[model samples]
Target: MKTRLGCLSNKSDSCSDFSEFLPPAQETAARSLKLSTDEAEQWSESFDVLLSHKYGLSAFRAFLKTEFSDENIEFWTACEEYKKIKSSAKLVSKANKIYKEFIDVQAPREVNIDYRTREKTRRCLEDPSPTSLNEVQAKIYSLMEKDSYPRFLRSKMYQDIINRTHAKCQRRSV
Candidate 1:
């Protein structure tokens, strides 16, 4: 069954219901994102809390897509992946790919960042340290935490999820 939860990739515009492409285990995990009412309510405890929950993160990603600013989250997640590269060659390649895909000016999936942070991130690419994207990623995180995250809490989509989860909980208790 097709669910409303599509656009699981960084490039949201080209995304289809690509959940079908997930490995069986991963697909089961995706389909298993049944957030309880308390879990849904815990989303408002903090932005970090929301991001830490897979269900909350997926919901937030969908919310970001509606706001047309999913790129910020995408960039944030890309930096996360870039930071995990243990091999030097892999690190460099991933850093360059991230820069081209989300950091370079007019990148295909360019994130919203000021020129100063952009330049700083660009300069870091020359040295290509593991922490090269840290500052820029932090900025993006701040942006989402301050701006998008608050709005997400107030979004109708979020409200609907809470209501759905609550209803599910109620029915189970009955």
Candidate 2:
């Protein structure tokens, strides 16, 4: 069966009078997708391929009609609004995904021993002390002027030295 697409004759000088296929939703769809400028142009070509395959010459002529239509200006304007809405939706979806991951992996903070070791090393450098307990305390107090030198060595490595000093102090007290 032969499809009669649009009317065309020598009587009408303007080409706007003829149109008999789907109006260009290609431009509208591309803009609504909020594609980049380069992407939009590439999309236009792809849209033409799809339309041409679907409707052939009839769709091609309809595209010309849209190029000169005053009433369809609103259609193009609506496409821009659709683009904004679609872009915002994508951004919101991405944010929600990150928030969900954060909630899923929520855990309590763990005490970091590496950080503690580094702090202790820095203190030792600032206040170099002798191997003996009394000399170490005197150096720590004289150099840094802080109370309770025994409490400063709280890590497991220094616990034995602190225990020995406590025993010595206990014997002297007796």
Candidate that scores best on lDDT: 1
CA-lDDT, candidates in order: 0.77, 0.29
RMSD of each: 6.1, 39.0
Candidate 1 residues 75-119, lDDT tens each? 888888888889988988999999999989999999888999999
lDDT of 2 by residue, 1-174 (tens): 012222222232212222223344553333222212232123234433322332322323343333332112222222233334435455345333322321122412111124444344335434322211232223322322122112222322123223433444565589
Question: Which one wins on TM-score?
Answer: 1
Colliding residue pairs in candidate 1: none
Clashing pairs in 2: none
Q: TM-scores across all candidates?
A: 0.84, 0.14
- Give stretches of model 1 more than 4 Å off: 1-25
Task: Note the clash tally of each candidate.
Answer: 0, 0
